[model samples]
Target: MISVEGVAIDTRHWIGGRRVASDRTFADISPIDESFLGDIAAGTAAEVDAAVAAAREAFPAWAALSAPERGAILRRVADGIDERREDLARVETRDNGSLLRSHRRGVMPRVAMNFRFFADYAEKLAHPDMEIRGHRERVTYDPAGVTAIITPWNAPLMLATWRIGPALAAGNTVVLKPPEWAPLTASLLADIAHEAGLPAGVFNVVQGIGAEAGAALSKHPGINRLSFTGSVPTAGVIAAAAAPTIVPLSFELGGKSPLLVFDDCDLDLAVDLAVEQFDNAGQVCLGAFRILVQESIAAEFQARVVEKARGLVQGDPRDEKTDVSALVSRAHLDRVSGFVDRALADGARAILGGAAPEKGLYYPPTILADAKPGSEILTEEVFGPVLTFQTFADEDEGVRMANDTRFGLAATLVTGSPEKAERVSARLNAGTVWVNCFFVRDLGAPFGGNGKSGIGREGGTYSFDFYCDVKNTVFSPNGWKESSHG
Candidate 1:
């Protein structure tokens, strides 16, 4: 076990603002070197019962607080996260095998920002006030009771807070089911919440495999709302579990997104964007690994991308200069490698890496050209550092190729012309389209997918809409017309 900021990270469930043990525990093995990290408590339906009860009991008082009051607590939470950013970043890197530099610079900061942004947003939240046919109307958002949040392994703290921040800011008590692979930071979050003076039972974390803790949390009748971020198949399971209870669900699922490069684009920027897919070993759902380059410039772009991929440093995640690191686990590494192997057999040509390292969980930044059209490598979410090259002749062909996927979470466009960027962005079948950029995000934008990628948006007002029950009240313009009937 590792200690951060003089506190030994607890692996037990964080329920009612304290650590609670379970009957069984599972070992958390680090992907960096396969070392044993800690023993995580295996939570089950019984633990879920205790957690839901805690949240249910805490809901009334939490929701009763004024928006600013809750916002103040969240701001403190954000501050606490910032104060321990370095410690938390190290823990996250050790647990998940994501680069230390990334966690310190981007992931950890974004986790804090998720809370701060929502905190201020809650204070300024406003619904439309209107008058129609001599009737005055105003809307209010009432907090949905006990929220069940299930977060994925990739960028665990950031994603968890992305959902948790809004849930708590909207004044709903939360019980979060963090991915078993990287559950350490969540326990630390429970500590930070307590230190930040967040009331007991306000935020809870249950750490275990999805089948046990996750299924129980989603299937709980007491849960008023659920938000999950993970694979499409896991989402299907959660949807099934929640359906029986009729619980309101918000899902942010998988993506096999595309990055389109037009002939009239900045070549340097397009090449850099293509290289960015190698970030986090390409675990990003919106990484845009499928590059649809304009046929005229396709050869040049592929050559540049290959050179960049080859130069990437693959080693320990703790090293600051390491550009790539291990996949989350041996099994996941195999899964990613299997997809590449099959693609090569189906006529795809590897430009950089086509195989995994023999010793470690490391899979090099792999680029493939001429992937078969209907193959799994082109159609499925590999969720690794694997890029596929496809060429399009013109604008119409590029847009068509970009939209030719079951997933529509996000798309990237690289072009020099303003008119083309605007026109093409509108036509792309994605919830978010990036013009000359990638992974640039705003907390207030609507952030979810269109098709199998996800259901419902969860940023700014969209987040509150899902976490709260929007209610409209109508009355006569002048004090209900003095109760004319009476």
Candidate 2:
């Protein structure tokens, strides 16, 4: 047990539906003030094996439950999350430096909804049967057995629930490895699932660094599938580890997504969206690192974006007024600052917020102008509260610039004309496209990326498909008449 601001938190691994102690423990430091929040269990390969073995042991019984029965349990989990929304939100904020207000009003609600959506969706699944000539074919979906869910630090609980909800709904036992930077919420979630009557070994969480816990889960032979969300390099490591067994893998990786601002769009709205590049201190993978503006309104748009970004309050995440909070850690803050420094060295001009705060892991909302097309800041994922500005003379040029990056996770286009929206949206290579707005999400819609951004899709039916395996059976009216060649 560890105390966080006077609250005692049990930071143990939830395996086999019980809190399991580990030989090693790691500190959970708050990015807001570098305060010691708690100690998390430092899981290892041994823990991974134990968790996977438990999941395998529980698979048959858990999967034997009817879809509606499983969905009822998930619905209960969603309700439980909603009941503890405030507590979960505060813990998430303290653990990951997310703004308190956003976590309460935005993140927690989405986390609950992820469970509810998957609960409802589970009952709606159909494995249709077909009949042709004198033969009949039937399709069925089965759980993919033991699965490992490796989530990122940003929006820890929300992202974990995004995968867990569907994986559970599909009747698959789960072993989750929450990011070491933010593991409190995931630990709490395990307790909630237990209280909601989730069976032992049906869901488990092992908290530790990526190399030990994550790699162990990825390479574990008992795990039939691995779902991950993180950087490209980490995804590659996971791919390599799981390749030996040919285990199915699903990844939602990094992105240098673009936000296109057209001349015909509302300037104020465009500026608002551009300013949102710093949301979650711009730690989000879907954030627009590159803002493409039309030449005609480029000057005015850039000024507006700079002004809005400059006005964003940078302070304690617990304060509702603070729009920009600290990065996940000191090292991450330094990495983000280094991106700006390198861009400056490469001839990019810092229009606003070029330096880090005097104390804490805070980097103010930064903007770089005149960054070359292929420069580091422009092409690579800075994953900070920084946006690079570039101007295009025409629609074709704007679309070209948006698709220039190797990442194609997401893109946003601001235009009033539906025709232009359709045309531009169609041309963008990203997995998700938003017209006239940014960060608007629907749980039922598919989400993920193309190219290096990630592989496979997530959300709604896509998630169910990934977590479950499909089988087809064929029957002939004439039992032994299928030997025409013989």
On TM-score, the candidate that comes out on top is 1
Q: For residue 220, give model 2's deviation from the true position in Å.
A: 0.5
Instruction: List, residue by residue over 174-216, the lDDT tens digit for candidate 2.
Output: 9999999999988889988999999999999999999999999
What's the CA RMSD of model 2 in angstroms?
A: 3.0
Error of 2 at 61 (Å): 0.3
**lDDT for predicted candidate 1 compared with the true structure:** 0.92
Clashing pairs in 1: none
The TM-scores, one per candidate, come to 0.97, 0.97
Candidate 1 lDDT over residue span 103-209, tens digit each:
98889999999999998998899987898998879998899999999998888999999999999999999999999888999999999999999999989888888
Count clashes in each candidate, considering only residues at least 3 apart in sequence or on different chains: 0, 0
Error of 1 at 303 (Å): 0.8
Measured on C-alpha atoms, candidate 2 has an lDDT of: 0.91
